[model samples]
Target chain A: SQTIHQWPATLVQPVGSPLSLECTVEGTSNPNLYWYRQAAGRGLQLLFYSVGIGQISSEVPQNLSASRPQDRQFILSSKKLLLSDSGFYLCAWSDYQETQYFGPGTRLLVL
Target chain B: QQQVKQSPQSLIVQKGGISIINCAYENTAFDYFPWYQQFPGKGPALLIAIRPDVSEKKEGRFTISFNKSAKQFSLHIMDSQPGDSATYFCAASTGSGGSNYKLTFGKGTLLTVNP
Candidate 1:
């Protein structure tokens, strides 16, 4: 069975700080990876998606960026975080069927 | 622009009652439709899905009804339970395989099944 992992499960940071969130999938190779953010009581917003290593597509212009350093490893980063950047970050993986499976997610709080 | 639109921003239903959520799409190229259920602070999970070729598909207590002519689809939960209380999302996408497909999701509906 395939599983996805993300960390830290919860994060708290001051404004203007750097941000880094990691996502890794096991039991699958060359899977499509995606980054999404959900604000409080809001819908999911696609931030970035990658087809392969070093290939990333930005769905919307925002303060965050994504990188696929490895086949199953994806990272979401920001040089400086804004108050609006705080939200629940989700990592998802999918195969050719277009059915996406999600990770536990990371909750970031900016003060 | 929002390609998929879902109705009922919030719903409250008593236990054992039926729960229904509706979604409509404008894009005719979309061949895949899926519904996701999300608990508080958790990632959304795929609950059920239906292809355009099928008018209705049922699995266990969940069912997906697709109306190709109206460009609409809906999810029905029979005998709704408190455990079914969660946020539901509807998504549609074009293409079938590979990394070429991207899903356009609805704003989401919060469903609360009172016990």
Candidate 2:
């Protein structure tokens, strides 16, 4: 069985502060990882995706960035947080089938 | 452009009643359809999925009915329970290649099951 771990489960950051969220998957290798932001009562907005180490694609232009340091470790970071960054951030991964399994999600609140 | 359009921004259903959510897509290239269920402050979980080749697929109380020509699909929950109350999203993706499974999700429907 595969599991995805993301932390911190919840965070409160002041405006213009640096931010980092980590996601790691177990029981799979070379999986495609994705970062998605969900607005309140809305659907997901794809932020970034990584096919492999050091390879990242920005689906939407914003302040956030993603990196794949290891085969199963993905990180979402921002040099300076924006008020608009407050939302639910989810990390997901898929194998050949692309049936994504999501993490518990990080609830970010930028005050 | 929105690849998928879902109806009923929110729905309220009484327990033991039927719950139906509909989704339509403009891209005919989509070959796979999936429905996800999400609770408050949690991630969306895959509930049921269907292929264009199949008209309908059912798992327990959840069923996905796909209409290829119509470019539409629907999820039906039988004997809905309070536990079924949550947000539902319908998504579509094409699997032409091994990596073409990038999902495009709908706005999502909030289903409220009243006791």
Candidate 3:
């Protein structure tokens, strides 16, 4: 069985601060990873996705960026956070079948 | 051409009643359709999925009806329970090619099954 883990389940950051969220998957290798943000009571917005290490694709242009530093480790980072950046960030992994499994998620609140 | 539209932004149903959510796509190239269920403050989980080749697929109390000609698909929940009260999102993708399963998700429907 595979499991996904995310850190800082919840975070409160002040405006103009930096942001970093990590996601790691176990029991699988060479899996595709994705980053998405869900606004309050709204649909999910895809931010970035990676096929392999050092390869990342941006679905939407914004202040956030994603990186696949390791086969099973993915990180979402931002040099400076904006008020609009506050939302529920999610990390997902998929195999050949492309059925994505998501992690518990990180809720960031910018004040 | 890559857009998926869903209806009924919110729904309220009685326990043991039927719950239905509809989704339509404009891109005929889309071959894969999936539905996800998300609880408050959590990530969406894959609930059921159907391909264009199948007209309908059922799993336990959940069913996915795919209409190839209509470019539409729907999810049906039988004997809905309070536990089923959550946000449902419908998504569609063109193919399973490497790094191409970019799913376009619907706005999501908030289902509340009253006990």
Winner on DockQ (2 vs 3): 3
For all predictions in the order shown, the interface RMSD in Å is: 1.1, 1.3, 1.3
Off by over 4 Å in 2: none
Could you give candidate 3's per-residue lDDT for residues A1-111 as a string of tens digits? 999999889999998999999999999989888999999999989999888999999999988888888999999999999999999999999887868888999999999
Give the winner by DockQ: 1 or 2.
1
**Per-residue error at B92 for model 3, in Å?**
0.8
Q: Model 1: which docking level applies?
A: medium
True interface contacts retained by model 3: 0.75
What is the descending DockQ order? 1, 3, 2
DockQ, per model, reads 0.80, 0.73, 0.77
lDDT over C-alpha atoms for residue B7 of model 2: 84
Worst ten-residue run, lDDT, model 1 chain B? B94-103
How close is each model in CA RMSD to the real structure? 1.0, 1.0, 0.9
- Give candidate 3's TM-score: 0.98
Model 1, range B1-115, lDDT digits (tens) per residue? 4489999889999999999999999989899999999999899999999999999999998999999999999999999999999999999988564466678899999999999
